[model samples]
Target chain A: MAALVTVLDLSLGPLTGDNFVIYRSGLRWLVSDGHVCRAGEPIAFCNIGLRSSDGEIRSTAPFLREQTDFQLTLAAPMPGTLHQLPDASRGGWLDQLDRYQHWSESFIPGSLDITGGAGNQSRWRLIFSAGERMTELAEDRSGRLTGWRRIRRAWHGERSDHGTLASLGTCEQNGVFLGEQHDFSELLAASPGSLHVIHVGDENLVPAAAVLSDRMRRDAGANALLAADMTQAVLGGPVTPGPADWHYAGSALSALTRCPLSERYDLLSRQGLSPSVAVNAVVLSVNAEPKVILRHRKLGYRAYWHRFRVDTTGQAIRNWLNVSFEALSRTIDDIQTDLRELCKLLAERGVKHVLIMNALSTSGGESIFTYAPFSQALGDELPSVRMKELNLMLHDLAEETDIAIVDVDSIAAGLGAAAHLPDGVHQSGPMQDEVRGEILHILEQRDFFAPPRA
Target chain B: MLLELSLPLINPHMAHARVDSILVRPDKKIAIGQAILELTVDLSDQFPHDCPPVSYYRLCASEAAWLRHLAIAAGEKAAVGTLLATFSKTSDEAVENCASRALRTTVVGVTRQWQPW
Candidate 1:
């Protein structure tokens, strides 16, 4: 009988849900190809970034600005065979979309590794081992391997080839050897079948969803779906606005020292800046050109002041205010509607299990201020209020549809105000744990996973 | 007229709940939709076993009323429909009746007792 492969497709993008890039940049690969990793094991290290003191190749783009000097590491998303795709170094700037499409097409469903990274530094690595003996390895600064001697000895005790480097390298490829190579195919063949839990959310859901997908793969042998750059679809809003609508902010100190916006953009593009890397570059433009700044200031003051005056005087401002609100409402409604349609489509495709995460509220209750530049100019209360309304809509939809709602708000609220960063949206460890736990609970309730092998 | 607010059946499977905290106090005027009390529903027996047995829920007031009497104290578990509190139209009436229900109010298991209001 053919071995059943459980391929987990992770679709992550820059600015998808909550800012997963910060976590993604920090990830360090742990398990090799066809290696087993247990649930909650540190398969990869995330939330750590790369930094160089020599000021090597720092792009002036806002996102890559800070990355020029330092970087954070993100954790390994799941447990499976680590199948790393070709690094971005092999492709040029224009070839990225094509490269990504090819990677997705070539991906065999049920594999845990995901594709696409920011630049040459970022690449896809997957964990394919579901339920095998987890061999733990240690490494030093020079990328030398340690601790594999014991595992090798244990697997091939008294064998003539036990301590050989060639044998060690071979053992690393598939699974541990008890005189013969133990491939993951044997374990997978024993299972019933595979199911895919496609996560559709922004960056916040990325790391948590990845971990949850890993857990599901380890415990239930299901394929957790992920994608690169599905933010616009999941968020139901414009992710990359035109340069004209982009807002730029800077501290007085930064403004003084900052290079011109055009120069910075040129520097960034010259350095092979990706859309993911451009997220912050668009916002934190410290040295905006004088002309651009003056133009923006005039436009901002005129638009805001006029609107404020109109609002206070009980008159609509060119009916644009209502149009913006209608658009926002429509966007939120479309998010729900799109999710429902996605769920229905998945069900028709024989996917009975679906988990949808509701949009989480910012910690300080100020998501509006954070998104002011990209979104329409609305009062402080509107964004928060609309978020609550969207969450409520999700709850109602879950009850009516086959989809199960993951209460991200409750998880955020449970963690208290300090769990959130100053930005009020992005979360780290505690929040990730909460969201993961909630997803696991939901999956368990649905009986999504198969019974563990005795 | 006096109105009785019982421990509502937030979840159909919820058999018992512990009062996590009380947001409102006796003789305090609370508006409609204001949180009255926080309840930790005991979900140990529900599906997805091994999860946190208790889920927190904030029971809010559906109608505007003055909290008259506290029947169940914080950290106490009561069956569904247990009298949680009583409300009246006026604060004076609530304050006047607070003394009568003082003996019945048995406080237990109260932790992080906070009055943000």
Candidate 2:
């Protein structure tokens, strides 16, 4: 029997900006040619750059922070085998730099041979990815979303009025949202409506409730004071900072000063460049809420870094951290209060949905038969006990606020934590898929796809 | 009866584990259910990156016994099935015997509130 074949032209659709020319580099194929692709699977991507029509560039230009690494990943509109045109791409700088060709709506670089079906779709569904590099010197063009980005984001759907979901969780959330490729493959395939996702790295500073709330409310004077104090500490400290230390200081300062919750986006859609307001939904992780955080003795700001990450820093920054910060313990009530304040501030910003991913409270390898030898205050000493307490507190907070728990505890438990979540933190592939489905379900329940609020 | 302490597979993704801290001293009586060893399994050891998949675990004694010999120390990396320590039912039992089996232990995942710095 002969397999039915239909050619579906993959054309560059309407990608525009006001008084600016949007140019794209040659196609960078994610998958090899003749590879069968699933529907909505990202197959190829290209670097996109914006240049002024009048040859005038300014610091206040739109997407100034993201213009350096702006890109668009093209997804397969339907299931088919991808076949690129012979002159589709010229390797080297011709494919690396975005100044080679202007974006034309009718430009067809490739065609999909749909097997056993006839489809009329010709326009490529765009998945836009942008990264704000930690430093301009850290240029890595190895793969999509590569290099050191202080903030990385991607969005899909052609509608200008898209609902944005900001991910401010730990690595657990990172795997679920960004997938194994770090290009949002699973999320893009699953999300049917207009959706935007932004992920902020937690390598330098964990985005706890205290840190996030502080970032949301910090002012210019406070930012100036923080920058000055950091500068003095790293430059004039007892130990001289090396290149590694300076790089860490710069990236850490950038993470500390920026407020992701209040960030606006310059979105490129089928119509043109549309300015998006703050995110419609924010997802956090209960795992990020530490029981103790470091507070600067003189500056009065809070900071927390993963133990492994702190060990990797240079001696100068380590010395600064050890001397300049004091440890403050937080009780369950304190965590609840911080979350409450964060939700209040977000609500004031007109955000209606706050989905928090609860921690996985069970371990497959654990078999604690007794607590006779353990500390008396189990909730304070044991990780599982404290997580249970925190999860309960989140349930209580949900009753009083618009916060919704993503309920990873229940989901992991239901899916068999031993096989899915081995160490109680990082999840397996099946586990991540389940978490992604639950997140999208929660968004659907909250009507996240409805028209944007005025 | 003599018992041995060998590294068990704590995390599925980890091929080797590091001895973060050993809480028990050899020749001392360790109570059942008491924490005896702290181990760390970092996936970054296998897949190196900035934000590694690191986890902490504590191994508690499942049977009361006299600690006999220690084979590993803190800051040492051991592969799975490597003997970590030895124990005996009595304090003065002969330490050289191959008739006994691995020690019974209960592994618990833990969290550290402070950083190494």
Candidate 3:
């Protein structure tokens, strides 16, 4: 059918922070669907070749998702047209092109073309994916993304539409408007019913902001200087959350999922903590589910209660709090004792064993967490002092018990973009997923929640 | 507790009262894809108080249709599984919606004044 046209927007679009969300959600969905995919993988979807303006922006995706290492197979039932582009000369942020573009002729914009077959197939992407699927599809590896030289990633907060679903246009309108000019929907749908894998040359599309985020994350991000710089970036302008941007909400959520109780409470409150809240956290063990419980303050705030079950011989993770207002030192001891008691309770309940871990907030990407969008008048119920107390309790408990809280603070500090927390109390959603994986790694190491016999 | 395997078992833990997953009583089947059954927990009748405190539950769903049973439990007196979550593919909003309703339903009783500070 006229080789379905597609346009892959390689124009350093700003990120809406939904990319991480998509990544986490996609990861879970793919895993749940029994598909093998990794986080941070760029996804391309299909659009029926219908166009609104009948111009360049085709209604569907142009480049097909090739069976590459980084990209997953999105087509159902049958395989789609595939393309394997040549290797990149340098892996870097698109700024390299400014030198090559108007400044230099060698600035080969990061784009590809897909042809269904040799010579006869029509070119799918006129700008990004210029041609069609080539025979070398299998020759290139998806994991080869490691080869890119990775220039500094620039955070383009603008340009991505993923972040502005409510703020901007709908996917359908974008499909038509951007399609008439350069619609991403067309690029996703260009290759009809096929797995098209396009190799990225020299230029890596992993967003510069993500790299900067990574660097700052590794640096503890708490340095006031870094926070100021980030604030400047947000104000000084990254890509305006537009069509060009990709939201990393998936990864953020994934990262946040692994947050220790001290930090995760805010995220859990997103669904409007009506006292009984439901949160989707990835379980570390195959058959073992973590003991996720709702804790509440007792009459006159004397104590709080959390109730969960241990699968006979299964030991699960739980967050225990210290109700005392004693000095951090004295309260710390009490928190530790409480954690030990809880673990002992689990042990007695036939829970094989328990692992206690403490959690702390990283400095990077936390400023964004300050505002509560869901809060009608800005739910200010949870304050820093309260949060600190929770952290202290977790730490104290860790000292007393064996289930050491993984240094989520350091790891989060190292995770630049994924850890971009909006507030000190809680992290962005994408980070939750990353934290979940990190905790899973911890679980695996201890052989705590081992996969039961299949 | 004993049912087929075509439902999605969802166990969401809020606060302290947490229950991660719910595997049918007899068979140790991991209630995934098609092993979950449809469940409806009535919050209005479950507890005398509105919005029982604890919020958490295990979810199991049907494969083709996202029809899953929600094994919601709020060990705390404040929260209970008051609303029912309908299952769907792609987006799993049913449970979250029900949970929100459950909370809002119960949150009305207490006098919560907003302090901007």
The chain A TM-scores for the candidates, taken one by one, are 0.32, 0.95, 0.26
Residues A1-454, model 1: lDDT tens digits = 6545555543321221121122122223445545564322333322212223332334532333322112111123444454433331232322211112221213222235323332322222221111101122222121111111112111110111111111111111122111122222211222232211111111111112112222222211111111111122223333333322121101111111221211111111111222321001010000000001010111111001111122222222213222222211134454455456545544543445555555444324121212222233221224344456666767777788876666656766776644442222334445644554555566556665444445
Which lDDT tens digits does candidate 3 get at residues A134-223? 223223222212222111001011111110000011111122112322222232333121111121111111111112122223323333
Candidate 2: the clashing residue pairs are none
What is candidate 2's lDDT per residue for A1-454, written digit by digit as tens? 8977888888887777877888889988888989898888888888888889865557766778888688888888889889988776888877778887988989887888997654557788888888788889989887788998887888874667678888897888888988989888788678757888888878767999988888888887898899999898878888989877887888789877888876667787776777655778889998999888888899888878886676777999988888888887899899999899999998898888999999877666567887777765777767888889999999999989888899899988988887888667778888899999999999988899765445
User: iRMS of every model, one decimal?
Assistant: 22.2, 2.1, 17.9
The global C-alpha lDDT for each of the candidates, from Candidate 1 onward, is 0.34, 0.83, 0.25
Give candidate 2 regions above 4 Å deviation: A1-4, A32-35, A115-120, A451-454, B1-32, B35-49, B53-55, B61-105, B112-116
Judge the docking of candidate 3 as incorrect, acceptable, medium or high: incorrect
Off by over 4 Å in 3: A1-330, A353-357, A361-396, A416-419, A449-454, B1-117
- Each candidate's clash count: 46, 0, 166
Best by DockQ: 2
TM-score of every prediction relative to native: 0.27, 0.90, 0.23
Select the stronger candidate by lDDT from 2 and 3: 2
Tens-digit per-residue lDDT, B1-117, candidate 3: 112222121112221222333333321223233222122222323445322222222233322333334434323122333323234333333334332111111111111222111
- Shift of residue A76 alpha carbon in model 3, Å: 9.1
